[model samples]
Target chain A: MIAVMSGSFLQRGEPAIMDKFHRTKAALSSGVDIVLELPYIYAVQNSDLFAQGAVQTLHEIGVSSLCFGSESGDISRFTSSYNVLQQEQPAYQTVLQKNLNLGLSFPEASRHAYQQIGLATSEMDLTKPNNILGFSYVKAILDHNLSIKPLTITRIKSAYHDQAITGSIASATSIRKDLLSKGHISETAVDALPDVTIQQLHTYKKQAGIWHSWEDYFQLIHYRVMTMTKEELAAIHGVDEGLENRIKKTARSATSFYEWINKIKTKRYTWTRLQRIFAHILTSTAKADLQPFINAKTVPYVRLLGMTKTGQSYLNDRKKDMDVPLISTLAGTKNPLLSIEEKASHAYYSIIPGEKKQTLHHQELKPPIII
Target chain B: MIAVMSGSFLQRGEPAIMDKFHRTKAALSSGVDIVLELPYIYAVQNSDLFAQGAVQTLHEIGVSSLCFGSESGDISRFTSSYNVLQQEQPAYQTVLQKNLNLGLSFPEASRHAYQQIGLATSEMDLTKPNNILGFSYVKAILDHNLSIKPLTITRIKSAYHDQAITGSIASATSIRKDLLSKGHISETAVDALPDVTIQQLHTYKKQAGIWHSWEDYFQLIHYRVMTMTKEELAAIHGVDEGLENRIKKTARSATSFYEWINKIKTKRYTWTRLQRIFAHILTSTAKADLQPFINAKTVPYVRLLGMTKTGQSYLNDRKKDMDVPLISTLAGTKNPLLSIEEKASHAYYSIIPGEKKQTLHHQELKPPIII
Candidate 1:
């Protein structure tokens, strides 16, 4: 119930209506005892990092659950598969390697291998939706060994990647698309967005989604991959066995990741497994690094998004008995992940409530989310 | 196995490989027997229509077992849902009325009421990737009373609507994004598409996702909703109550279907449920019309996406006992859904092989899937 805020969520981007100060104030306005701000260290990174920062902030503050979304809202299936993944890593590895040997791309191989071991296809087709975010949450929770459970508030109809303006409740891509297409959300499309969230459409769309495409990023990623030596490739997030050479050689001819996968997929190798490998590389994730987080327990913190008046009172009463820190902000930047994420947050918001830079001032008054 | 080929399958949008000539030929090549061409009528429509058409075709030809995807991929969840939906009509009606009283849209009310009554909310989350397809299969199976057993292929990793391309297998949106950015797919992106599929990248990128953003066709849907009259709406695929009015009004403000849903959603309204309404309006389905089919008792035949030599032989040996039509194609049209679907199949291929305006006649050839 404790309301938490990621103050100054965007720099250069529009500032959140309730900066951490406003959000925290708003939370307190509900008559809650106190509001906490997440450290700037984690607030400004990519979504996964953001999720981690937000979740970690709350966990440290002592929260019991982390609600999120997934393509298939079937929690049991998600849990089953997740557990299976944890329990049968060796078998999965065997299948993964076999599929790769058959020339399958990592993603596809992973998907097919999962299916062979009993799972649903298309039902949670990661290739078409916001599955990465879903997985990121799962991975974060698993890696952190948090006691806070994960729940999801399933979203309505909309493909997460759709990059065209259709109606309201657009895919971030669509919102960004419309923003870029007209350099502003059409007057009509505004109703679909919360007043606080609209700048998301206005800013990212106006700057990044409009001016550049994933294609623009491709070459950079390719360069990153190409420049890597064998050791570096092996050190990348998902690199295993001889994949570094394959990626290096493939980088020479493959202009897009899509082309590279087609060259790799086979009967045994599914597209999803290969895609994961690429993701690991793009994010600089190393198996060695990830290995620790795979099954580790994530601690719980109450990083609040928004809370009602009644919710605040609940948090105040409960805070005394909590086992973890009720964190409002990071006291210092100790973790590299947190620091880097904090730095990156400002760059992404260059066009929103257009801040020139990100700041870490103590926030005591800001709130956009309610309940 | 008898292999049937319909000349119009290519026109319906299915890969020619799915056509009787191609499917059966593929089966034959794989060493199967007895490929019958599904009447052109039932072979071309969408899942709903295809279900009806396939059921009728099977009944006429005598077949058994229809396999499909279900989100939970568990019989208990699927069956439990079906039983509840089937038996709780009266309670659902009462809940629907009360929700509508609160100004909730029919779809919103229906879903909310269902959730209130302990129906699973995850099933109601429309943003789920393959949920609609799975639900449709369920509805079709129930309506047709066909003895087809549903089988699901396990999906791993990504959710259906995810936009961020991860692993090696990018979402179709990412593929289209890559295509849109490059005008033509780079070798990397091209490799992501099925090697045999055609491409119409610009069209896909412009719309968002293939077969996903059909808002342009809303005028037709809206017109049908507005002019159809209550009785007609009731008869339409998913219309119930006076939702017809809300749909018409929403259409006026709605720039897109997704927008329309926002205007119309309420505690009772569900997006998929709403989608079903539109689908019904377009297809002209009715509860009573579907009632008899839902009570059917046997599967018609197995629809093959592709098969290997062993797969073909398995079918060949089991054809007679299938107790349904083992069709592959049709020389002429028979069902409206199939016809519509047949015409629409080409849309999915709009971003792969870089083709434009695929012709029906050209859909006849068959090629190995090259697993």
Candidate 2:
């Protein structure tokens, strides 16, 4: 089938080491018939919203089935977990709000809320990061009454947050950490990845060096925080509950991104959550800017990032049946969604420093990959 | 008695070698009794608007006389030039529009229009850059019916655009060029500057190394141009006609800022004008954002950069007569003008790279230099 994945920036608020174009080529070389880009705004966000966007876009494109990697391969468990979250949402949310008010982070509060509600054991076992997202996908599918059936493949090795590679299947986190530490992917890591993927990664490294990290964006964020008033920052999404004051004050004394985050983070916010909020601030994504998309019943359009010959033919056959516009290239498109995508791409490329700028893909100018 | 100068960024859209705090101290040690900052928005504009902002700010602050260096120190020539630009306005504008339609740049068109009007021999002699700015200052005073008396001082040693360090008084352009090319200011160049200025520049160099040029901002500009529509670019103050199309077309293949500018520049727009427009684009200064400030009778406020005790007493004695606010620190100020300044400073610091970020001055957080 098709893979709808993050492009340019990942959920960690860092540039993808292998850019989307090459990544699509790698996917095409393998069994994937097509790969679609989840717009950067959704790509680099909290997993719940990230999963919702990806699944909704896929479902809108008329995909009949969906598959994802998770800690457990049991489809019934994830399905039941979604049912519990949907049916008991009132009780779940009440507990969630209580936990959140007690200064617990979203993930932590979610787990506590699920455990207190005595839903399925699977819902209580929200320890694996992928499992949490796996439930989100199923929930989105059910919530929208989509016909797409869901399946999960058990992750072979390595946890999502594991910083070290384990066996043949390593977490992308470990791979990124290794790439940063070693300044290049090692042969061992290459062996774990598909040949096409390795080749693409190597080519990108040679041309533009390693991609940038959140640290590259720290100065801009620090400057923005320092210059903005607490009220101004408070208006941004996820910057409520006086966190703006903490961010503004911390940004003044802390010299680096990690230091600033560490100073600003409390039990109320996880590092990832704080980073996602900071990413919004760094891009100036206010609540007003995101409210429409967040409240939309489904993603309004499908962006085709790449396609194989067979996939192109399939799309051609189904063109008239498709309800949403499938955007292959952003060149002259004036849709509201594309506008947000353009702004996000601008923010992504602006933070990358040095010769890497030459290799940066201007998302609007770049055409979809065809292999 | 008072010097109004550009802060952080200069007319060329490059960061100042010395930060504003140091520059103000240097001015105080030199002959200037008080130094006020020409806000970054006006500081980095073309000579006409740049002169207008600086002179208007000084006039609003109850300054009785305005003196500036020019190639021709003759006040009658400047006065006559202003009269031709003011009195024969409709004919001058007609000629200006005709010359502009012929694709000459604004400065070039203005020179041609003045010559066609045949007001004075001096009006036709628009060869010197300072003389052109001198004419603008005089015109602004006359147009506003300001009581500020105008005087001119003969420039010494070097021309404004001269790249060579000549005699004991070299152009600031030469000093900046040398600093960029040589990686450090040479002893010979140091001899040309006041001891206080040299000390300040040297201190900043030791702390933050050299400041950045517009090239440091090329990635951001390129991203903005690529993502924005021609209409959006046209909405920026200096971007007009089909120059937006030229910028967009040229930005596609050009690898660097200079290449982009060189490819986009035509007889209709000078490099300086293009740069000023690009600055506006980088700061997202749409026509709507500037219209309010432009329609105001004068700058709404005067910001003090630095002042000696004697200068403080001078301002203190005349404070009651000053029509506009005199802001020394932006700490808690909520004036509309400060909002623009804050945005400009945010844009300024966001482009600075690396360790220099630590040395970046938050304009609002900074107190005035009291020498």
Candidate 3:
């Protein structure tokens, strides 16, 4: 079966350890037959848009099912939650606004809204990170009236935000922390990651000379905010409510990326939301750039990052039915979304040292992996 | 008599070793009566504009004479060169265009134009940095029909671009290089600087924790160019002729500010010109921001950075005759040029560590120094 996943090309303004090529290769080596890159604009956004873009891309490519890991593994419960939210739309939105006006973060406000609408139950907890994402996926599928069925596997061994690696099946956060701190994948992290993932991590570290982290980009972001005027910062995507002034002021004294974020954070703005804003700033992604694609019925194109022999056959069988362009090589493609992806790719690899930087950057132009 | 010198507030994109307050104090202590800041937009620019802005500000404040150091110390030679250029305007323009089209930098092309028009003489070598600026000052005085007389002192002991400190009268470049490298005023640098200047330098380093250098800003400029699209960069002041593409491409592989400049340098673009462009980029000074002041007969205002007792009396006597405002404090001041200066000041002090950063940045709002 084809496997669709959100690649961490850049996750919340931080570059991922494994680049697109290596990650695709790892997935194909594992059991995944096909790998399609979720466009960067969607991949680096909040959960609702992220799920919508993924669901829409899958529907366009004629996928029949979508499976995700979540705290609530039962599929019917997610559907019930989605239905309850749909039935109580007015009340839900009103409660959401009230909680938000009371200075709650979006996630916290949404959870409050859900509880206020009586959707909280012992069998289903939507507060978990994976469950929240799964709920978004189910909502997107139902809202778009796509013919894809939702599936889930219970997440185990570690919590979604877990910072310490446990038995096996550790959260990505813990694994990244372990690998970055040790300068290589430690024994505990190796236990959690598949063999292919471990190999990819090793290869990426050796070739890139550094693992991508928030600190790697601290100087860049600080310069951006420090140099930008209030109006310019306001023009960036997700910089609202005079937040530009705060960012500009905090950037002057912030010694590190974490410190800057903490200084700017308040009860209303969550860390994740702030990270997304910073991601947009680093990418130079303006609000105008995302305006057209915010509610796009379908993504303009589906980029195939890699494919196995079986995945190639599946594409060959379904090529005619696909309506949108499937881009593999970026030599001359001109879609706006694809252009943003290319720019983001350049930014992602801009910090790599020596000749390896140019080599990795030029990877944007090469054809996708076929194994 | 009031002493006027170009403050190294930020010279060609590098932060001055001494900030405005300390430099003003140094000038006051070393027998200068008044220190008026040449607006940052003009200070960090090329020679013609720098001279124009300084001459204009001095004229606005009713200064009777402008004195500058030059290899060609005789002021009459500058006047003769200016006269020849004025008489041979058409021919000079043609030869300058031809040399530029033949891929020569502006300064080199202008020198060739001078020779081609038989304006270059053994008595006055326009190729020298001080002579070039002296010529510009003479031209500005004549062109604007201002009442200021131009004077010159023969520069000795060190060339304009000297990188080593020697003797009592060393170039500012050499002193900066020495101090930055040694992390203090070396005995050699001390000899070049006056006792007051040495005291200020030590105080600045003690409080600021580090001396400012181009390397300190390499990361910032690198990040700015890396994240900015070609279109966005082209909009910055002095980024033209598709140089944005070169800058964007070179930023990817460049490891430091000097390396990036060297990589992007061509025969047609001089090192100084590139530094000016980078200064503009770092300050986020757009081409549109400078359009209003480019050919204006007078600057909007003259900022008083500091004054001694005699200087304060001079200002009191001349204040009534002044047409434009003499701004002492930034509180509630509203002018475009002042706004740009404020923004640039923030960028200049952004790299200072800890509470010192905010303290220095807030100096922009503080009243001018009176000693």
TM-score of 1: 0.33
Off by over 4 Å in 1: A1-66, A74-94, A121-154, A187-191, A199-295, A299-327, A330-333, A343-355, A358-371, B1-371
Ranked candidates (lDDT, high to low): 3, 2, 1
lDDT by residue (tens digit), candidate 3, A1-371:
67665554543445677688888889999989889988878888878988888888898889999999998899999998888888899999999999989888888898888888886666888778889889999999999788999999999878988989986878888888898888877789878889998888788877888888877777566766766778889998899999998997777668788899999999888787888888788878899999999899998988888898899999988888988988888888888787677667766775665577777666767887888
User: What DockQ, on C-alphas, does every prediction get?
Assistant: 0.01, 0.27, 0.38
Q: Compared with the true structure, what per-residue lDDT tens digits does model 2 show for residues A175-222? A: 777767787778768766778887888886665555557776666666
- Least accurate stretch of 10 residues (summed lDDT) in model 1 chain A? A351-360
lDDT of 3 by residue, B194-273 (tens): 98888887888888877788778775666567667778899999888999989977776677777888999999877878
Best by TM-score: 3
Compared with the true structure, model 3 gives a TM-score of: 0.89
lDDT of each: 0.48, 0.76, 0.82
